[model samples]
Every structure is written in structure tokens, then in C-alpha cells.
Target: MNTIEQQLWEYIDGDLDEFSKKAIEEKIKSDARIKVQYEELLKLNSAFSALDLDEPSMSFTRNVMESIALAPAPVAMKTKVDKKIIYAIGGFFIVSLLFLFGYSIYSSNLSMPKLDFNFNFNLDRYITPTVLYSFLFFDLVIGLVFLDQFLRKRINKEH
Candidate 1:
């Protein structure tokens, strides 16, 4: 026969075979020590099961919301484009390029001793300026649209 201590563990864990279970019950009838140990384990299990299920404080949600609100409300939704700014920047770059070309043309005509060199037509020079200015314009428009939406939302909220 198995000891009461080992039987009690198997019984608590619900892992005993029915014959083993019956044998343990029969042993418990004659053993006061086993019965007392079993009763103490049962009481401990019941006490653990009866814990309180109360909710946290109402201030918990409010505190979380307040903390989120206090965290500097996102840098006012900036845009990738602003049309007026783009046009102004584009105009500045175009003027600068024209000045550069004029200076280059003037400097090229200056007297130079005979040197064997061939001028290479860099397609990049033209493509780079146009592409850069166009992207700037696109970004400016996007930024302006975003700014407009942000302002409209703010105005609506105020009203």
C-alpha cells in the first residue's frame, strides 16, 4: 500500500487510478495524521480560490488620460509641401542658376593658352536642377495642404 503522504499528493492533483483512490480512502479511515494533513491542504486550496475580484480606482483611467494629454500633443501635424514656399524657392534657384550660367559663359571667353581639352555635355547639370526644383514644389504643395487641413480642424474645434 502507498503511504498517506504520497496518496494525498496524487489525490490533490487528481491523478490517482480508481483502485488506488479507494485504497487511500480506506487507509484515511484508520489514519488521523493523513486526515488532518488532507483537511489542511483542502482549506488552503479553498482560501486561494476565494480572492477578491474588485476593480482598480476610477482615477486610474483619468490619470492615464491626463498623462497622455500632458505629453506635448504632437508637433501640430506639419506637411511635406507648402506651395508659396516652393514657388519662392524654385524662383530663387532658377535665378541663381541663370546667374551661374552667365558667369560661366563670361569666364569661358577669357584668353587661354592653347590646351587640348574637349567639353563634355553633362545631361546631369540640366536634369539635376529641374528635378530638384520640381520635387521642392511638390513637397511645398503637400505641406500647405496639410497645414490647411490642420488649421481647419483647429478652427472647427474652437467653434
Candidate 2:
């Protein structure tokens, strides 16, 4: 009377313990409906288990190895960059940096147009020649530090 499909599958698969196995066996013997269902499930299980697996060709591995050996080793996918293109890009960046440097120096020297707002304070008074020069030196040091780091990284990358 206790007819769970899963228990029947477990029974068919030989997974149930002795007590459960005996209980199902008694149920099947006493109930004609349970017996028919159990037989049908066993038949389906047997049909699935009896299927023949397709075997591979005898020289499958040899054919694979031969094909691999015959073909050229796969070339790494890398762009074939021309030296001229790299130089052109470098030249462009250098020219831009030079242009910016010249513009900054030129603009700093050019006469400033008169401002409508009257200011009594002068920035140059606070930033004396010594302070200005010291700031310039610090800026130069920072630039050199960055340049050194960049050059070291570039050298390591090339290696």
C-alpha cells in the first residue's frame, strides 16, 4: 500500500536496506497493482541500462596527434606594429608636450590685460623671488622623480 515511486526506483537500483527491501517485496506480493507498477519500472530501467555505448574509432588518438603534428604551432595573436608607426606616435606625443611647455612659458611672460576689479593685494609680494625659485626647484625635483620612475618602468617592461 506504501507505493512511493522513488522507493520503487531505490528498490530497483538495489539501494534499499534489507528491512525496506523486505517491506516492498511483501507489498508487491500482496497488491497486484503494486506488482504491475514495479515490473513496468524494472522493464524501463533494464531498457535504459541495456543500451550499448558508441565506441570511438581505433586510431582516434593517433589521428589527433598526427593532425596536431602536421599543422604548424599556433602563432601568438600579436599585432605586427611597424617601427615607423611607433616612432610617429612617440613623435606626436613629444611634439604635443613641447608645444604645451612653450605655451605655458610664453603665457606666463605675456602682459596681463587690466582687470575691472581693483585689488590692493599683490600675489608677487607674498611669493618673493626666493620662494618662487624654491617652488620651481621643488617642481623640477618632482618632475625628475616621475621621469625616473617612468624610465625605470619602461626599461623593466622592455626586458
lDDT agreement with native, every candidate = 0.74, 0.76
Worst lDDT window (10 residues) for model 2?
115-124
Q: What tens-digit string does per-residue lDDT give for candidate 2 at 1-159?
A: 454678888899999999999999998899998889999999999999999989989999999999999999889988564576567558656865875675465446444457544323345556567975785686677568656766886797689
Alpha carbon lDDT at 141, candidate 1: 81
Clashes of each: 6, 0
How high is each candidate's TM-score? Answer: 0.29, 0.43
- Clashes in model 2: which pairs? none
Report the CA-based lDDT of candidate 1 relative to the real structure: 0.74
lDDT of 1 by residue, 1-159 (tens): 456666787887788999988887877787898889888877876787798778989899999999998898667866465576678668767876885785476445444457745454445555566876896787678668767876986797689
Model 1 ranges off by over 4 Å: 1-3, 52-159
